[model samples]
Target: MSRSTTATVARTQPKRAVLAAMLLLPALAFGLWNRPVDAQEAPVEIPAPATTLNETSASATAVFAGGCFWGVQGVFQHVAGVTKAVSGYAGGAADTATYDQSSNGSTGHAESIQVTYDPSVVSYGDLLQIYFSVAHNPTQLNYQGPDHGTQYRSTIFPLNDEQTGYAKAYIAQLDETGLFDGPIVTTVEPQKTFYAAEQYHQDFLTLNPTYPYIVVNDLPKVAALKQLFPDAYRDEPVLVGTL
Candidate 1:
């Protein structure tokens, strides 16, 4: 099934039995149906931003949209300094942020995550590094993996002028390095209100690790985070439930 069709079905059923059946399908068959034409299966190694923000506050918030929020949130949840990583919608009005509306790809929303962290422990630049490197492929224009829509576009919503400057600089730095085969399509959007997704979507990767979608697409992201950033990776994910 196509990603959109699969998403519609998943939402309607929301049952483990249905998901388990998907898991039983052969991996080859699953790949044929769901994998991206040019998926970034492996994480890239990118340099830290030469310019980073200096924040006096203990807590800071950063929002990013890069493909599905499940994998992006999962990746950050494993990072040491992230206090909370929430799956949500951004780049649209609050009323349009609901999953059902956002799924249509015309809600002006992108599936996104709000990451709350302690800047002292993990710099915004560090999170940006992980975002560009392991969370999702930035070069993909408007989709990630089998998912295709404006809702799956890669974007960064900066909270302030400092973040805007850093994000733009980092994007330029990554582009100049020629690390990615194509130019990074990730965009820096004006800050938008973020609405947390429904309860079922929170900590989805942690709660449903064996769900076919998570198994096939998201698990690799968490693995890459652990392998690529050992110092930043935590053994226990800081789950949304705990927040």
Candidate 2:
């Protein structure tokens, strides 16, 4: 009951409170240190493999039947980008479709030229330009000039997806640009079996230069290609045409 005894009791109470606070500090520090880490592990970064562009010599091939294979083949041969041109038959039934059979309009095959060109040199669009301007008449449906039948129809047989997309887009662009007076009847289909014509048909104009057909039909194509694409034509083209 005395003042000194009461003061002593209060000071002892303060020491007890400090000791309790020190005891709780370890639990609080441990809880802060052990806060939950992300349950998921850090994702690993895997390096991606390098992609490559195909650069084969025969990178891209397309078949086109403009009018006459002779003229078509000749025109493409002069083009800078064209690697080789083979007169052939396409869009036909799977059988031995030859010039004789195709011309008769019974084989359902077209008198086409298989053009192997380097995409790095010239684009497919440029090839189409040569096709429409000097290669053959796109306005003509199922026929080119005197030739009348599916054998002379205008078509671009695309070899790959890129070619397919480019073919469609080019046709659509030509249609929109009003390049042709009538509908562009050129068919863009997936490439099918291409049968190279017999050896005799390979370079008919170049061989038979003085032939009447070459003078009238084939020579004009050559001249037009030269005039249209002077850069593509060679001054000393093959002198195989000796009539």
lDDT of each: 0.85, 0.64
Extract clashing residue pairs from model 2. 206-241
Would you estimate the TM-scores of all the predictions?
0.88, 0.70
Please give, for residues 1-243, the per-residue lDDT of candidate 1 as tens digits.
Answer: 753344436442333343555657676547634655344656898898987688879999999999888899999999998999999999999888887788778989999999999999999999999999999999998888767788999999999998999899999999999999789999999768888987777888888776677877788888888988999999899999833
Over 1-243, each residue of candidate 2 has an lDDT whose tens digit, in order, gives 442333223222332343334346766434433434221111111111122224355446778888768778877877887777888888787675765556666776888888777878755666766776677777789776555677778888877776677767766766776645577799887857788876666666676675433444566666777776676676444322222
List residue ranges in candidate 1 displaced over 4 A.
1-24, 27-39
Model 2 stretches astray by more than 4 angstroms? 1-58, 236-243
By TM-score, how accurate is candidate 1? Answer: 0.88
Q: For model 1, how many clashes?
A: 0
